[model samples]
Target: PGPLSPSPPQLRAQPQGAMQVGVQARELRQPMAMAMAAAAPGQMVMSAGMQQLAMLPCIDVQERAQWLQEATALLGAEIEMANKYRVLDQVGNQFFYAVEKTDCCRRQCQNGLCADCTSWEVDVLYTPPGGLMQKFLALRRPCSCVCCCINRPTADVIDEATGQKIGSFRDPCTCCSLRFQVRDASDTDVLVVNGGCCCTQPGILCPLPCGPCAQVRFDVEDAESRSTVARITKRVPSCLSWFFAPDVDSYHVTFEHIQNPQWKAIMLAFTIFMDFRYFNVNRNQEQARDVLAEL
Candidate 1:
């Protein structure tokens, strides 16, 4: 059994070192907490956002493999789902997480002709899977009229913390193929995203790699010389069992040379925009078209 509690008289006779030992314990705890706070992000598989955004510059196919961040992304913002994505690097380290944001009212309004025609504004928040979960980017895609794909569509990339536009991606309204002019904060065109289609009617998904044998992709070109600098290619999802799981998508984004992180983020947003505008309508009609067996 432990000794009984010391009386007041016994406590008065205690050594000064005993009192100091008690004080030292509490003081030691403060620094330990600070160290833990500083080390929390280091525990992730590899750093997110920073590492992926510093895209590996490659002039040939050999260097492309290392830079491939094959994202598992979702689609159908214009259809039923709002969409979500878990962007992963080649080695499966999560680069970032993205989820679509549309007002409940706006989502509910997505019905009838308005369903396919309404280019309702959709926002996507980009954040890491763990740690502080602070938003890295906020993407706002404005609505576009899709009647025969003649309209110009645009998306704005804003700094999550500051709410200021870092850059923008806009279609220059090409008639034969799909095209976009990626501009920086100063509105100077930095990159061009170009795509060719099998059908003459382009835009929508036409600007994306849409040939039967061709890889579904968009070539990121230099605005000045129209040189191919990067490419965003859509990859099929691994799980294909769902009849209409209202599937999401994934893409491999690569750069021949990229100097800015903001541009990388902006280009990523364009992939999601392409999915919603082009790949979404067909799946949306399934609810109305499916043959019903009386259950």
Candidate 2:
């Protein structure tokens, strides 16, 4: 995996539903993490937690788009799989490679023994490159990114290296725009991410705070003061990429105002979670559409 170039995901037959995706998300593995940790020991940037938010140069460096581009989203159009992203710094320097992984055995286990696996829990891993090889930030979320108006998407952020629960993101279920509450480990709301205000109560001809547009953004604001402290942005590649491979997109995070490393890590985790929840073209949406067509 070159810094910005990740080989296509392993081609396998993905099942037809979200529950199956959930069955495969867990337990006893870090092979991919191990491999990359050994190979790119030098590429390892400073840790952001106990390591501190010392990598400002790498974090804020020119604010150039640091992409976590999806793995070959279009080598074959119909192949559906977990999301894989090539993380790069603002200058296009490869920093971390991210991918979501699952265990397929549970699909047939039918024995109800896979208690460790939650209904929609997804374990995303990154190593020195892949091998679960090592854990950076382990994120938990629903397998299906798409949710009806009743289902508000939420995600949890965990620091794997330290094995500490950092925080979580919860949606307010606003339909007209995008809004998520960024809460600390205590589940206390600390920051609010607004999708640029579209008014859910009235709700019409309004653009969602999170959309497919190239520069869609969600501003991270302080809960108490309600001041913009940081920002998360979504960027798309060429027109061809968006159409053929909807999952491939770039995300930029700004931390000039908020310097805490733990919160920063939480924000980063949410960015990945948000990408899958808002950007990826996974199985859930396709199945929903099929059901709708049949109806």
Candidate 3:
């Protein structure tokens, strides 16, 4: 599949509840050290330990917002999904992550609060057969970007077992379109995200006639080669669903055809980053106002 622009490809169906899926997350004590010790330059090696932790295969991930108030009550931000969201496969095997924000000011804030005004922390975990949460990928908002709106900040993707960074979500220019670059620890490019339904003009809202087609689409591609690997499509809701439940945006991500296990994790992180940027930057609010005013 290519980018969604030239010709849109048929996307995969969204996965449902986590109750039906069986998920297991193994601890990676020293993922970086093991990766270094196993292979020489120009060669990639997956040790037995890595193979154990990388048990989850590539698959479509579905993320549906629980409710609008539930999100604002937690962080006071205009975010949609601020609680724990589960990533499940077709059969219901699930992995989960909790989105948290800290360093909040006690007084009422302007624009947004918590992650919008402070920092965000995401905890990646998976439940084993016995139902205990195992930590996997941990991410934190970059310090420089937490307070500065002009600076495009990145969220460091850390390996919980070793407490070392394994990758990062690189945000593009704040005035530019909605796009992101995902890179590994070595600063090697992995995935490039080009989000749709975006207004390229800075400080301007989405044009009037585009409201009916206000679906958000993300084209995930190989960063280096620029080949399409996956796609995420969020549909435009009906009029009532839009006005009454504006924040509950559900995204559908497809990655079954992809073979790389690492890519799956990176894509999942990218998915979270998409929401983080959308709410933090106030794009969602702008779009909502535009659509409603037009209506």
Q: Each candidate: what lDDT?
A: 0.48, 0.49, 0.51
Order the numbered candidates by TM-score, best leading: 3, 1, 2
lDDT of 3 at 36: 35
lDDT of 3 at 248: 39
Query: 2 or 3, which is superior by lDDT?
Result: 3
Candidate topping lDDT: 3
For model 1, residues 127-176, the per-residue Cα lDDT tens digits are 44565554666677665565554656667776564456766777665565
Residue ranges of candidate 3 with Cα displaced over 4 Å? 1-82, 101-117, 145-150, 174-176, 196-214, 235-242, 279-295
Whose lDDT is higher: candidate 1's or candidate 3's? 3
Model 1 accuracy (lDDT, Cα): 0.48
Candidate 2 lDDT, 76-115, residue by residue in tens: 2233344556555566655455666534442222113332
Model 2 regions more than 4 Å off: 1-53, 57-77, 103-133, 142-151, 197-212, 282-295
* Predicted candidate 1, C-alpha RMSD: 19.8
Clashing pairs in 1: 73-249, 74-248, 209-217
